[model samples]
Target: MKRPELVCPAGTPAALRTAVDAGADAVYCGFQNATNARNFPGLNFTPAEMEQGVAYAHARGAKVLLAVNSFPTAGRFDLWREAVDAGARFGVDALIVADIGVAAYAAEAHPDLRLHLSVQAAASSPEAIRYYVREFGVRRVVLPRILTVSEIKDVKKEIPCEIETFIFGNHGLMVEGRCSLTNYVTGLSTNMDGVCSPAAQVHYDKEADGSVATRLGDFTIDRFGAGEQAGYPTICKGRYHAAGREDAYYAFEEPISLNLATLLPQLMAAGVEAFKIEGRQRSRAYVRQVVGAFRGAVDQVLAGEDPELADLVALTEGQKQTQGAAGSKKWR
Candidate 1:
């Protein structure tokens, strides 16, 4: 089987170094602005930090993929433009972008720099994938976390660019780049602002009945019992009351994570060029552990040994995980 590139996340310069040392083939991060999707407070790097991150990764024989993945607004197009330029200036190995306008600018101005389609583009079909490749010279495309392994193989056969998929981390079932719940509540657009359910609007409070209520912008989304684990309060994962049901339940997606380490061999054989881990806002320890574990697992797969999986249950949100749609035909 062909070994795939192990792409990991780096929220900070420290996480970049940690991921590289943990044996990541490439690390993807964004600038601390609205240009990238994971633009959470206190995360991502500045231009100088990105330059240093590139140097750190390159010195260790690893590559840095800058995530200028967020869509720019009409008048603020310059933020995205400057981001594409910064990638070229910092000597980043590739730019992971979702906006066609940004991609066009990159292709026109910095044709030498590599381009990877972000999952935000939702280019599952071969025709859609080829459009980006044909229009923008995109070299790779990050597949949405909704395709089965067989489906991915089928798409790979018809597409020219390389395929990358999430092997671990957030398994949010919302169509990438399409959710607007955060904007409706807090007026923060996930696409244009690169933040969803901004931390400033999140609140956790102890309720009167010994339950913990999770609120987003003064609206309580869910209440956890005394012993139950409270999930991160994103609109998709929050529970809601319904007329038919006596109890409240998750309306859209449940709080769960994706763990596909068991399918490493199948993914490699399916023409997947890269495996991506998807937590850019997590802690440095989380980066080190997940990257290290996946590194060992991928190496073992290449060596034809049992990938003695490390116990990663403690790191996942709400201690819950699923194989997602990669193994099953059913969507949910």
Candidate 2:
């Protein structure tokens, strides 16, 4: 089997170093502005940090991918432009971009810089993927998390560029590059503002009944019973009340993580060029553990052996993990 590149997450410069040391072939991060998703406070890198991060990764033979994936607002196209410019200036191996404008800017401004289509672009079909490849010269496309293994194999046969798939972390059930619930609730757009359920608007209240109520702004997203783990107040994972059902339930999707350690060989055989881990908001410890485990797993798979992954259950969202659509044919 061909060895796929192990692309890992790096929310901070520290995490970037950690990922590289732990054996990541590449690390993807964003600026500390609205230019990328995972724009939570206390995360991402500043200008100096980005340069240093690029230098650090390059010194160790690891590539750095800058994420300029968020859409630029009408009057604030400059921010996205600056981000793309800064990424090229800092010597990022590639710029992971979503918006057509941003991709165009990068392709025109820095023709030598490689471009990877972010999953946020939601380019699943061959035609959609080909548009980016044709228009902006995107070399690699991060496939959305919704495709099954067989479906991804079929896509690889038709698309011209390399394919990258999420092997671990957030299941991302929502439609990519198109989330507005946070904007409706907190005036912050996940697509444009690069934030979802912004931490400033998140609230957890201890109810009199000992259960906790997770609120995003004034809207109560979910209520967790005593001893139950209260999840982050993301709109898609929130439970809601309905008339037919007496109890509240996940109205959009449940909170679960994607773990694809068991499918490394299949992905490699399917022509996947890269395996991405999706947690830029997590800690350095999380980066180290996940990257290390996957690094060893990929190596074992390439050697024609079953990978013995350490138990990563404790790090998963809500202590749960699933193969999602990759292992099943009935995901909706």
Candidate 3:
């Protein structure tokens, strides 16, 4: 099987260097603005930092992909446009985008620069993938974490561009680029603002019964027993009280991360061109540990040995991991 490129996350310049040093073939990051998805505080890079990061990665034989993936607001398209231009000027290898207008602007302004469709686009089917390739000249696509391995194989048969799949980190259940629950409570859009449950609005309170109540804005999302692990307060993964159920239960999805280390071979054989790690909101230490483990795993697979599963359970949300839809629809 052809070895898939390891495309890792780099929230900051430090994370970028850590990823490259740990064995990433390409590291993807974004500016500290709404142009990208992981717009959390203390994450992402400034233009100067991005330029330096690109240089550092290039010197180590790794590429840098700038993520300008969030959809641009009607009147604020220029910000997204500027981000793409800056990425190209800074010598990034590619721009991962979702918005059609952003893609058009990149194609018109930076024709030679590579374009990768972000998972936020939700272009899973071959026809949808072909449309992006034919219209925007997209060279790669980060497939959404919603398809099965067999489905991915079928998609590869029809699409012309390289396929990238997330193999680790947050497993989102809602349709990417389309979540608005955060906006409902906190008035901040994940698609446009690049933040979900912005940290400033997150609150935790101890209840009289020894339970911890997680709140996003004024709304109590989930409550956990004293001994249970409390997850980050996000609307989608939050529990709710309904239908006479006193204990709030996960109304959308559980707090489980996706770990597909065991499926590396299957993904490669299914024509996946790259493997993506999805934790730009995490720490440099996390970037180093997870990237290093995956590096060893991918190298082992490439060397014809059994790939070892990375010990990333502690890094997962709620200390739970799943293969996600790639393994089975039973997760749904």
The CA root-mean-square deviation of candidate 3, after full C-alpha superposition on the true structure, stands at 1.2
For candidate 1, which ten residues in a row score worst on lDDT? 323-332
What is the per-residue lDDT of model 3 for residues 1-332, given as tens digits with 9 covering 90 to 100?
78789999988888899999999999999999999998999889999999999999999999999999999888999899899999999999999999999999999999999999999998888999999999999999889889999999999999899999999998865987899889889899999999988999998899888899888889988888978976778999998878978866888999989999999988888999999999898888999999999999988988989988768999999999999999997876
Question: Candidate 3, clashing residue pairs?
Answer: none
Across 44-125, the per-residue lDDT of candidate 1 in tens digits comes to 9999999999999999999999999999988999989998898999999999999999999999999999999999888889
Instruction: Give candidate 1's whole-model lDDT.
Output: 0.92
Q: What range of 10 consecutive residues in model 3 has the weakest lDDT sum?
A: 224-233
Badly placed stretches (over 4 Å) of model 2 are: none
Candidate 2 overall lDDT versus native: 0.92
Residue-wise C-alpha lDDT for candidate 2, range 153-178, written one tens digit per residue: 99999999999999999875688888
Residue 175 local lDDT, model 3 = 88
Give residue 127's error in model 1 in angstroms.
0.9
The segments of candidate 3 whose C-alpha lies over 4 angstroms from its true place after superposition are: 208-210, 244-246
Error of 2 at 223 (Å): 0.8
TM-score to true structure, per model: 0.98, 0.98, 0.97
